[model samples]
Target: MHDFCFAIPYGLILMTGGVLGYAKKGSTASLAGGLGTGFLLLLAGFLSLKAFKKGRNSYLAMILETGKPVFGYRGMVYAQSS
Candidate 1:
């Protein structure tokens, strides 16, 4: 539910761009681009949710939830605090 909630809006924006491109120039490439981008974002959101489920207190999730940079490493990844 959480992943879907985030993915839907992102997908809608991309889909709208694709529709606009098609309307403006009738290019199939524009339509494809929009669909591709939206799908990628949706996938990313779903993956993030899975990560959250596995590690509710994971460093990445903490930083993302707090909307702030956190220093130190979670495995090989490090975020520089600001």
Candidate 2:
């Protein structure tokens, strides 16, 4: 139910897709976009998990999980709009 739970899996999926795209079609864009976004999400997920262990929330993870709005301000709104 936590953000990290989804973010981690999503990140892994993105990363795998990126690698597959590059391997199957040599698409640099896909590789870059997928890998970059995936890495950010994965890092954010880890941060969230760490915070959860300490009984805290990770705004950074929440922001990234929601499409990573500017400075995380209005992230939920942006996510909804998108």
Candidate 3:
């Protein structure tokens, strides 16, 4: 129902995946992508959650969540190119 509801878990998953990837394969890319995007998602989630509590919406959170797909797509494209 709310962006924060999903974003928080998704962020945590990404962060965990990244750490695991690095640990298993020593992939800096995975670590960077996971931690970086995960942090952003987490931040956005919290921001939106905070705003929701105040009966307001956070455009920043919306923007970040909306843009995540694009960023992930780009990451895939970049990985393929390399």
Candidate 4:
């Protein structure tokens, strides 16, 4: 699911390129630019996901160490007295 979320933007970009290629009567430059944009979008999304995961793990660790509950759809951990 996460991977699909990441792929959607790039897929849209590539689709746009294909459309432009047909529209421009098969211009190679337009196709190439579209591919490039798609690749860059994928790369950016990958990096963002990596950063977010790293930050989330660190935050979870902090909360656990402080004995605080981490609440979400995930299971809750009740805080323990020091």
**Candidate 2 total steric clashes:** 0
Quickly count the clashes in candidate 1. Answer: 0
lDDT of 2: 0.84
Q: Give lDDT: candidate 1, residue 10.
A: 76
Deviation of model 4 at 64, angstroms: 34
Ordered list by lDDT, greatest first? 3, 2, 1, 4
lDDT of 2 by residue, 42-75 (tens): 9999999999999999888777777643533574
Q: How many clashes in each structure?
A: 0, 0, 0, 0
Off by over 4 Å in 1: 1-8, 56-82
List candidate 4 stretches off by more than 4 Å.
1-11, 14-24, 56-82
- Residue 57, candidate 2: Cα error in Å is 0.8
Question: What do the candidate models score in CA lDDT, each in turn?
Answer: 0.59, 0.84, 0.95, 0.51
Which is the leading candidate under TM-score? 3
TM-score for each of the candidates: 0.48, 0.78, 0.93, 0.44
lDDT of 4 at 45: 54
**Candidate achieving the largest lDDT:** 3
Judged by lDDT against the true structure, how good is candidate 4? 0.51
lDDT for model 1 comes to 0.59
Error of 3 at 36 (Å): 0.5
Instruction: Give the alpha carbon lDDT tens digit for every residue of 1-82 in model 1.
Output: 5544666477678878988998999989778867766655655556567767786534443334333112213412633333
The TM-score of predicted model 2 comes to 0.78
